[model samples]
Target: METFDETDRRILSVLQREADIALEELGARVGLSRNACWRRVRALETRGVITGRVALLDPAKLGFGLMVFIQVHAARHDAEWLEKFGRAVREMPEILGVYRMTGDLDYLIRARVADVADYDKLYQRLIRKVELNDVSASFVMEELKDALALPL
Candidate 1:
């Protein structure tokens, strides 16, 4: 792990809150010249501190109002089967995230869809594509808190 200095932490905090802040303003806030600030930002990027910036979208507004978590258990553990399942998951737009878990479930998938019918279609498609011994799903009733910001 890389140790971050006060300036780096300040830069990261400011950037996380306001990514569109002007370089001059960011430098002023961080007590550095524009050139120095730019260099630090560049170094941070080179070191993989800043991965990539993206616009977070609203799922409900995009017609995906239902959020569901699906637990998948494969019929058998094999390299080929796991590869195929992973590929299928990558091609699925509704699948927001897929993880290889360490519990009873082999894979945990987060999906968003329009309705129950949409979920049914997605479930059928997934089952048809992968050889699953068991599949269980849980629909999210309410999202109390969902934030991407990591505590630094």
Candidate 2:
């Protein structure tokens, strides 16, 4: 990744809060001319710092009331099995995120479902699709904080 200058950092900080902010407004806030600010923003996007803008949604309103984290342990590290597991995870709508870990678990998954029963059904389907040796799930009772913005 390319190192960001002070101006670039300022631009990123403001953009993280509100990606829809107008280019003129962003330039004004960062004390840059419209053209300079536009170039900086374009560079950020080109360098993959700004991946893409998106609308943050309410999970509950979207019919995903239950948030659960699952730790999955695969039987072994086989290329074919890993590929299949990755593909299954990508295809599962309920699985919002997946991370390969360095701890006791092979993979950590974040998923949202309707309820406990819904989670149970998802669990069954997930295990059947992947050759997981062990699986542990924990339901989130209260979400204290969830922020996607990086501290720039």
Candidate 3:
């Protein structure tokens, strides 16, 4: 693992919140020269500490207001089944994230769509590609906390 000092941590924390902040402005906020800040940022990127930056858009404004969490139970827990399932999930635009889980749930999928109809369409498409033992969905009523930034 790559080790970082205090300055690197400060830069990461600031950039996580405001990735579009100008180099000079970021440097000023973090108490560093613009050139120095740029070098550190580049180094962080090289070390895989900083991945990619993106604009976080509001789902409601974008017409993808409905968010649903799906618990999936696989019919067959084999390499071929997992591969096909992975491909199906990756190709679906509505599926934001999918994670292999422990306990009763085999997989957890997070998705966003326009409404119930859209969600049903997504569900149909998913079942067509892979065989699932059980599939259960829970709609998100309220999102109290959602922070993409990891603590430095």
lDDT of 3 by residue, 1-152 (tens): 77889999999999999999999999999899999999999999998888899999999999999999999999998999999999999999999999999899999999999988899999999999999999999999999998898878
Clash count of each predicted structure: 0, 0, 0
> Per-residue lDDT for 33 in model 1?
98
Indicate the worst ten consecutive residues by lDDT in candidate 2.
Answer: 125-134
Please list the C-alpha lDDT of all candidates, in the order they appear.
Answer: 0.92, 0.94, 0.95
lDDT of 1 by residue, 1-152 (tens): 99999999999988887888899999999999999999999999999999977777899999999999999888889999989998889989999999989988888999999999999999999888888899999999999988777787
> Order the candidates by TM-score, highest first — what do you get?
3, 2, 1
Root-mean-square deviation of every model: 1.5, 1.1, 0.8
Q: So what's the TM-score on candidate 3?
A: 0.97
TM-score for each predicted model, relative to the true structure? 0.91, 0.95, 0.97
Candidate 3 Cα misplacement greater than 4 A, ranges:
none
Give the best candidate by TM-score: 3
Q: List the residue pairs that clash in candidate 3.
A: none
Least accurate 10 contiguous residues by lDDT in model 3: 143-152
